[model samples]
Target: MTVQFTPDRLAHRDDPEVSKITAISLSGTNTERVMHIVVDLLDELGPQTPAELEHVYRSRAAVNDWPVVAFYSVHKRVSQMKKHIGIVAGTGVREGGAERVQLTTDPLKAHGKITAHMQGGDE
Candidate 1:
């Protein structure tokens, strides 16, 4: 089966997940920043552990003039993006194995959509 993605499909009002993801309330708490960083890192560095993500976030935050984000906060934002936005996908292991996260769709397209939404623009 093929899934078709279009502006109309993405704007479907009945899809609660999409609505939540596209909501114009992502400006605070570094949520949008984390999303961009995670997606960009996944594209450039491939799947990364939560620890690696925290390190990268700190580094990038300094360079980008954004506030430092905690690992738990990063994990929570990633979890929300995965569950509500479907931009990220990963598996959880309970036996002390590091979780790996990667982008589920085209990185550039996903980033653009997320950035636009975060900036209060309907994409």
Candidate 2:
């Protein structure tokens, strides 16, 4: 379960999806943490709407006793993840329906990225 990190062990190296995720250099304080949380949640839940993402974020924030994770924050992160990471894709919806975003890679591939990240490797 404990995957050791090395030059070759980076999630992006072996997986194309992860490669896209890691290709972009994240800037600003705490961006990395936000990206990690978004990736982890997507890996677990597959595709989701912005509202669903907000719900997940709120639940996590509550569990950690952290400040509320605002809906805007979740939306921003999701958008960034789609633009920079490339592992997530969005589907447009009708006027009343919410747009949905999901991982571009298959479940097994996502599992690889998730496992690598969970084990302290980079994605």
Candidate 3:
């Protein structure tokens, strides 16, 4: 699918901090794990600004297996998440210079009930 984002959205996402967090979430060369975390993140926050979402995810207890460096490059992680898990994401410009990222997939389907159950209600 064609990824869409406004110029303003791209500019905000290009922020170094955002990119860094994405990187950490996508590390470990494990697509399933990366997809799991991204979906879990969405489940918890619904939708959120990149910074807020990143902070919550990086600090979560469930992410113990997530790679540390993955938190350093959110941009790259986003790309990988989409490529592997069929998650389409969009960026929106919010008030006060914030950027939001939300999943384009339906949450129930995105979570893969089997795995989500294994993760203990993370979905």
Candidate 4:
């Protein structure tokens, strides 16, 4: 099924990958850091479920020379960024208490900027 996203639902978002990706991409000096993580995650699972993304974060953190705060904060920031840009898709809970999330349609297009805050080249 096609997942739909709306402003209200994004208000108290829980998924971190989306927000972290968006924030880092928007960060003038942190795009490389953000993109590197995102590219790795994307490559590993194509797109990911929220739980899977969390696992990816922990694994990457272990392998990379990044601190825990840096890893988690980036995840949270990317999630917020995703909400701001209206690119977040799916709700946090499914019928069986499972969380669901994935990159939005046209991720490459929607992913250009975390929000409309700036309109420039893609990260």
Candidate 5:
């Protein structure tokens, strides 16, 4: 399958994760917050499906003491990020019937500064 991402073929735009991001973060815009998590996850853990991301995100957020968001919200945010920022692409692999996504080679946009709870570098 080897899914390749292009501007015309995006993953998740116009999703509610945008608004959820707004509610969750006090600083930065919705896009900034989503990019922070999505980019950081992919950068740290390699490729993962949105579901995998959600699970990992939940775990990381717990360990890091951050607010927990839903898997569906993660699913929508990952898709929207793939569309708006072009930071992620489908990996053509399915785990639990969902496409695995990976970060692109583009310059890193979110350095995880949007998160205030992340205190240590152990993450």
Candidate 6:
């Protein structure tokens, strides 16, 4: 579905000095963890370009001492989340030529979505 949103909305939220999430408290690889982070970010802050997702995610990940570098780049992870998990869908309108994405209200359970994302072979 297409959506038109103000780029101004991207700056609507400020980064917190310390992330509410305690990295020492969570389990999973950096890839798994950041996936959770991006999903929650979109779910909370709404549709955002991949660049916007990186800005907030890296900042928050830093505060938690969670290494942001991983097997998949942040941009790729965002695309994977949508292409594989189905938790977030593209808004269909680029925020000034860059792709923008938002969360999907998939009735499928989280585990179900994840299972699909983890499947072998190309989709």
lDDT of 1 at 1: 29
Supply the TM-score for candidate 5.
0.60
Candidate 1 lDDT score at position 15: 42
* TM-scores for every candidate against the unseen true structure: 0.60, 0.53, 0.49, 0.46, 0.60, 0.60
Better of 3 and 4 by lDDT: 3
Q: What does candidate 1's lDDT look like per residue over 51-74, in tens digits?
A: 677777777777777656443556
* Candidate 2 to truth, TM: 0.53
- C-alpha lDDT of all candidate models, in order: 0.64, 0.57, 0.52, 0.47, 0.58, 0.57
Error of 5 at 119 (Å): 25
Candidate 2 segments whose C-alpha is farther than 4 A from its true place = 1-27, 65-70, 91-96, 106-123
Cand. 5 Cα-lDDT:
0.58
Which of the two, 1 or 5, has more lDDT?
Answer: 1
lDDT of 2 by residue, 1-123 (tens): 554333233223444554434433332223435556666677788678867877787778767644443335566556655665556788664223777888888655654554444356656
Question: In candidate 5, what are the lDDT values of residues 1-123, reduced to their tens digit?
Answer: 233232223223353555444434432233345557777778888889998888877777767755555346567667755664456789899889988998776334334322221222221
Worst 10 residues of 3 by lDDT: 2-11
- Which RMSD values do the candidates have, in order? 8.8, 9.3, 9.8, 9.5, 10.7, 13.5
In candidate 6, which residue pairs get closer than 3 Å at backbone N, Cα or C atoms, i.e. clash? none
Q: Rank the candidates by lDDT, best first.
A: 1, 5, 6, 2, 3, 4
Local accuracy of candidate 4 as per-residue lDDT tens digits, 1-123: 222333223324454555534443344334334433553465456655545665667677767864443434444434554555445455565533544554554545544544232333344
Strongest candidate by lDDT:
1
* Model 1: ten consecutive residues of lowest lDDT: 1-10
Segments in model 4 whose C-alpha atoms lie over 4 Å from true places: 1-28, 39-47, 62-75, 91-98, 115-123
